[model samples]
Target: MARMCAERVIELDYSCNGARIRLVRESGQDDARHREAVPAVAAPVVVQDRPPADDDAGAQSLPQIIEITAQMAGQFYITPAPGEPPFVTAGDEVAEGAPLYIMEVMKMLNRMEAEFACRIIAVLCENGAGVEIGTPLFRVERTDHA
Candidate 1:
């Protein structure tokens, strides 16, 4: 789906499982020049592997880790604002629908939230740094009830 503004366009795309979604906005172009153009949304892709059973490694399945990624290309902010505590940190327990951070695109602050509860294992991006669409922001292990 897409929506067009005066000089920008916003689009949303999702997968069958809905575990991955992408939101992207493009601006700075003349609306008249790209009125008919449709922005593309890229969904997160995952590939899994299984080790041979004869290997010494345990037979347990690999933990399902979800990588929280940036939906748009922009600057990422860990804190709500300067001088404020971060919305979340490594080892933090994130609740579903809770704001995880912010992404600034085209001078607009877009709150990026979690779709499911999870425990943060690592933060992949630095605060106030530029991030591209689908860039991994956090590595998290999904909660049992997620």
Candidate 2:
């Protein structure tokens, strides 16, 4: 008797701002468990003198940019626990109440659930990375039904 093996090659490109990739080998899994962590980079703050006192009609409302922002500062996690499969991935249609991500703060895991059905448009955060408050973690499209 002889054993047959499969050949595979996986490439991870971490060519984004504040991102790191981690790969895991698993048995019977076609793709590797790819984990990523990204942190919010602080932007340089610029203060400007109050707009000419007579040239303002108050701040105008602009179209809003919807994004899933982190509530607190902590590391982001895709799976419920280490070595477990992720809750969702890009292009995965998730229904309301679906577990989307986890936030680990002070060693405590907080599960983040979806509010509405949507398709994962992009994963904005990296696994095992620190995210500041109000950082976009995921970008999803709100679908009629998922």
Candidate 3:
């Protein structure tokens, strides 16, 4: 087997027969100490020498829909407690500092929030669903409701 190693999470991307795959292999313990991968525009980007599309609706939409991902690995939760109301649901207006939801990773509760004022367009994950580092939990549409 061909070995591909990196200090941190190594993202290997490729396309096969119209199927696209992005393999995100978690780094070793030592690797996490030196380099840290902070979630900042983690969306896939096709970098080309030429300038991007001028009227790029696709490009614009990429940044608008925020991705609440797992920092480590664990089940995702929408409510603070079981049988409790969810923080936000689809079509709900969310503020910048409002709590979007929680991602329980590594036995830790990671509370995710809206980067900016946005409305929850889609809830990609079901309640109590398992998630990895790059897994998308929710997709929010940036709205002017802050």
Worst 10 residues of 1 by lDDT: 41-50
Weakest 10 consecutive residues, lDDT, candidate 3? 41-50
lDDT of 1 by residue, 4-104 (tens): 45325477677877688776668545556645432343223222233334534443344557677777787889999999999998999988778888888
Q: List the residue pairs that clash in candidate 1.
A: none
Off by over 4 Å in 1: 1-30, 34-62, 144-146
Q: Which ranges of candidate 3 are over 4 A from the true structure? A: 1-67, 144-146
Best model per lDDT: 1
Stretches of model 2 off by over 4 angstroms after superposition: 1-65
In model 2, the clashing pairs are 36-126, 36-127, 37-126, 37-127, 38-126
Ranking by TM-score: 1, 3, 2
Q: Which is the leading candidate under TM-score?
A: 1
Q: How does each model score on TM-score?
A: 0.61, 0.53, 0.54
Tell me how far the alpha carbon of residue 37 in candidate 3 is from the true structure, in angstroms, after superposition. 11
Model 3 C-alpha lDDT per residue in residues 1-146, reported as the tens digit of each score: 24655433378788989899877777455554656554532321112223444676755544445555555556778898999999988889888778867766446677766667777777878899887766677776667522
Model 2 agreement with the true structure over 60-130: per-residue lDDT tens digits:
22211236777777888988878988899888988877888888766777777877676777787777779
Please, what is the whole-model Cα lDDT of each candidate in the order they appear? 0.71, 0.63, 0.65
